[model samples]
Target: MTSGSGVWITLEGGDGSGKTTQSDLLADWLTEAGRTVVRTREPGGSEVGQLIRDIVLHHRGDIAPRAEALLYAADRAHHVATVVRPALARGEVVLQDRYLDSSVAYQGAGRVLDGDEIRNLSLWAAEGALPDLTVLLDLDPESARVRLDAADKPFDRLEAEKTEFHARVRDSYLALAEAEPERFLVLDASASPEAIAAQIRDRVATLVG
Candidate 1:
């Protein structure tokens, strides 16, 4: 259960882990349950964040790992202040896709940077805000690749990285969940979307009840 009046739930996973689909399902279910749901995503939730998202995800060039980490932190700082905090202040359930965890997993572990530094930077940027519940959709790199390929869409900067990079990201996510079991609900991403969503709903119900 959330300590605050508003419940903040984050959905985290590697690329093609079905986070977007599951987020949609959870949002719809919460809405049907008569909750005020504010569904959003990092690096694109606010107008300022959209520009940062493009630079970090779609830009064609070599970005220094540290620069990339800072860019994400910039987006996160603005996003939480303008979007997430306000929603939570209004007592609305904020269902977010990705958050500081993504930065820790991608930039820290995948990019081989200092994980603690990356996490500290993100936490400082977000003013120490942390999600009440983090639902991690765990999947293998190969299965994630298959799902990404099935989408028939071009890969983004992170998605285009080598298999080893994604594997590292997954390892980091699992490690984070293990370190914070009470705050995390780690689910198998290979499961059907309905099943995944059902499990998420059950956990969220406890928070919003």
Candidate 2:
């Protein structure tokens, strides 16, 4: 948990699980409730992070799994130091779309790297910062793929991975939530956006109050 005057909330899940949509709604809800909300995401939250995002997510060639993991850790280090930590110090609610969980799920599980090592790398990079709450938008890979297809956009490197890869990622996320149930609100991502948002708001209300 963060030792600051603010609340830090992170959303985790597989691709096309509506994390972005729910993140937007939660930010709006928090802002309307008179909280100073700082909405951000990993891999691109900072200017330097954006360059790393392009290399890791959109670059045309195969990137070594270890190299990809390091890039994400680098971005995470800078993002937390430059954006997240400062906002929390100011007593703001930081609604982040992803965090260490992404690295663990993608590079660790999907890329078949060691999840513990990946998590430790990120934890060290971020100086051991952890969110107060993590909302896991759990969804089946098949449904996620269908949603991605409907978007009609080019898939990034991770998004273009096989169904088995996504299944592993989902499983890893569930394991993580189970390991830290006190800090996680695991919800079915297949539900209506409004319904999901409502549940998230309820969870956040307790923290913010």
Candidate 3:
């Protein structure tokens, strides 16, 4: 559970899987329902984290897998300490775009590191803070690629990785969900935005009220 008396929800998925769209809709719905919502994303959620994010996501050259993982952990430590915990303490719903799960999926399974080690490191960074709910937008790698290409945006470091890397990430996410069924809500990313948002809202309703 999170550090305070508020809901902490995380949205997770491969890139271009509609997490931002769903997050926006969820934030709007929660705010309309008279809840104090704090919208944040890990790896760039704080000032220090922004710098770390630049290295991990946009650096022109390669970063060692362990070094990359450490950067993410550092950002997680600062972001949670400065941004997430404070919002939770204020009784605000934290609608975050990503969390430690991203590290376990991308750096762990995708990079062939020990998933358990990555998860343990992330837990240490956040002091074992876990989300009240994790909404996983599940999508195939090819579909995600098509979506990304359609957006016509420059690929970030992680996004520019090979399709096989993304496939591993998707599998790892599903495995994590399977291991922690109660904390996860897995939804097909192929669903229409409105439909996905509706499912998310239904699940969130049970958590928030």
Query: Residue-pair clashes per candidate, as listed?
Result: 0, 0, 0
List the global CA lDDT of all models: 0.94, 0.94, 0.95
Better of 1 and 3 by lDDT: 3
Q: What lDDT tens digits, residue by residue, belong to model 3 across residues 92-137?
A: 9999998989999999999999999999999998899889999999
Candidate 1, residues 1-209, lDDT tens digits: the string is 22448989999999999999999999899899899999889989999999999999999999999999999999999999999988888889999999999999999999999999999999999989999999999999999999999999999999999999999999999999999999999999999999998899899889899
Write down the worst ten-residue block by lDDT for model 1.
1-10
RMSD to truth, every model: 1.4, 0.9, 0.9
Q: Extract clashing residue pairs from model 3.
A: none
lDDT of 1: 0.94
At residue 136, candidate 2 shows an lDDT of: 98
Predicted structure 1: clash tally: 0
Runs in model 1 lying further than 4 Å from the true structure: 1-4
TM-score of 1: 0.97
Candidate with maximal lDDT: 3
Model 3 gets an lDDT of 0.95
The TM-scores of all predictions, comma-separated, are 0.97, 0.98, 0.98
What is the Cα-based TM-score of model 2?
0.98
On a 0 to 100 scale, what is the lDDT of residue 25 in model 3?
95
